[model samples]
Target: MASEKTNGEQEMPKKKKNRNEELKLHDLLNDVVSPILFPEPTNSAPLLHRIKTSLSRNAPLIPQASRNTARDTLLWTRAGSPLRPLLLISVGTITILALTGLLVFTLLFLFATINVVIVSLLISLAAAAGCLAIFFACVTVIYIAALLVAIFAISTVIFWTIVAITITTAWIGFFYTVWLVTRKSLGFAKQSLSVTSSAISTYSAAWGTRNLKHD
Candidate 1:
């Protein structure tokens, strides 16, 4: 019985040491993988009800200083002069009004500035687009003009080539006609000279015969 009691006390301490030292990997994994706001209790409530419950459960705790300040202010208003409370209320009201006005003016100014920026951006985009269009149009016009000029130049070269060929042919025909006319005129002149010389010879021979017969 004494040995059993000693063994039991030793087992209790060993069990406690093991329990304290062992890390729960499964619980850590579950918390990391699927964290739950209220893990033990499964909630199937509507969205608004769930939101209200969640907000209530996590409500902020008020500090004691705020309560003391409130208490002091209440006491001051109750026991002090009525004019002091009235003046404080008036000042607070004026401050709130001024802050509200400033907030509204700031919002309006921001909105107007944003509108102006947007308008300026749109105008800039339009001007850039217009300039791009004009540039494209000018390029197209220039391309067309260059094409027409090239065509005109080609046509002028062809026309001049044909005109030169025609003039060359005309000159060749004129030179051939002049050569033929000169050859025909020279032949006629040689034939006429031969006929005249024969006639003169015949007349001279007959006259010499007549003179001898008379003698």
Candidate 2:
């Protein structure tokens, strides 16, 4: 009986040791590989260390003050130019006003010609009735016909003359304005280009000198 009990005791200790080894293996797996497979937060030391190291190694290159200065220079240069907007607004306004005036004049002249034709026709009819019994009826008819033709011709000439004058004047003004604006824009562009070129040359020379000194 004693020998049997001693054997049981020995087997219990062996089983306990095996269970402790298995628990230790489970703990090791949970620490090293379980997070990859099961997404459970056991510890964050490794992740935090990686983040800190990355931030320390790769810092931002440009300083804040230099960045602000570059932005301010761009803004100031843009703000200093006033002629471009002014030219655009002036040209647009003039074009619209000229077109409107041309349209108004055309409509008014057309209506006036119609009214003149109607009045002349009414007067010719009245004279024809009054002179129908006279000996000069035929002559009167010829005179009235000629008068009507002349009136039509005169009205047509006047209308066309007005139109031609208006169109020519508007065109002349438009072209002159365009030429002036173009010349101004070209001058501005040349000046801007010159300034940009000068700035670039200066920066390049300074950079070259800096590099030479470093060498």
Candidate 3:
């Protein structure tokens, strides 16, 4: 009975140690892989709802000082955001009115300036046209004078050419007449010599034959 009691006491401690070891192993495995095998449940709620729940959950822990500061910041942001849009609208309205006034003033000024300058521009244009007409008239007169000079020069050249041709023709005719008279005189002299020679020869022959017959 004593040994059995001692054995049971020892076995009890051994069982407790083994059970503790198994429990420690199970806890380690759960810590390493529990999120992979079994994830935490997710709440499918709107952002505002989630934020409200989170604020409610943490509200008891947040101090009164932090809450007061948060309230003040929210109030300032609400007030400032509304003022910004009003200010921007007023600035845009002022800028549009200033630009419209400037455009109207510029148009009125341009119209007045054009009305003042148009008559002077027309008078200057007329003066330019008259100057151009005078210049063209002078050029036309010069062209006519040059044409007259050219015609006179051509007529003088033609008259001198005719005179030179007449003088040349007269010289040619005088030379031709002299040559004809010389040729006729030379032919007449040759015929007279031939006739004189023939007559003398016949007279000498007749005188010799009469002398021989008389002898």
Candidate 4:
């Protein structure tokens, strides 16, 4: 029961806030629409009619062209007699000069553009030639360097081969010398042994003959 009372109290404030928001929205709409529906009256129509009547009554009686010429003549006479013709002539002359200047400037611009294009083309050609020359030079240098590297490699190989050949020759010569010395020593020892054996056998045979005679 207490919880229900508290829930009802919370819902009451939300409903009141919604009612306030709706009332504010309605007041804003009324304030915006009231002036458009009921605008204040003005005296502009009478003033505009008075202006049209005054203009029609005070308007010129002469044709428009004659009126303009009359006005121009009056102004010219008040200023000076010669100024009117001079002004017309000067305006025409200025227009002619402006057209001539425009034509001359166009021709000059075209000529300058052609010259610029030609100059740029020539410069590009020169630059391309320079680049090609540099490329060829680099290629030549690379070829020369490669040739030098190949020569160096070949020379190193030849030097090592010569060293290997010299080492092999020295080894062969040392072995041959050792074999010759061993062969000479063995031959001398065999000859001495054979001579000693023959001498001993002859002495033994003489001894045996002497003994037999004595007996």
lDDT of each: 0.59, 0.60, 0.59, 0.58
Supply the TM-score for candidate 2: 0.36
Model 3 residue 12 distance off true place after TM-score fit, in angstroms: 99
Better of 2 and 3 by lDDT: 2
User: Which candidate leads in lDDT?
Assistant: 2
Which has the better TM-score: candidate 2, or candidate 4?
Answer: 4
lDDT of 4: 0.58
- Which regions in candidate 3 have their CA more than 4 angstroms from the true location? 1-128
Question: How much is 8 displaced in model 2, in angstroms?
Answer: 99
lDDT per residue for candidate 4 within 27-123, as digits (tens), equals 4344334434543475334555645544453333224434455566567656864444444544445555556555655665576557556655655
- Ten-residue stretch with the least lDDT total in model 2: 57-66
Alpha-carbon RMSD, each predicted model: 50.5, 35.2, 57.9, 52.1
Quality of model 3 by C-alpha lDDT = 0.59
Over 4 Å off, model 1: 1-139
- lDDT against true structure, model 1: 0.59
Per-residue lDDT over 1-215 for candidate 1, one digit per residue giving the tens place of the 0 to 100 score: 99999999999999965643442434333333332344335666665665565445333312333444556667888896445565456455555655655565566557655755665565556665887656555654665566556556655655565566556655665676687689889998989898988998999999999999999
- 1-215 in candidate 3: lDDT tens per residue? 99999999999999965744444323434443444444457756655665565556444433443445446545665676344444444444555655655565566557545743653455455556887656555654665566556556655655565565556655665676687778888898988988988998999999999999999
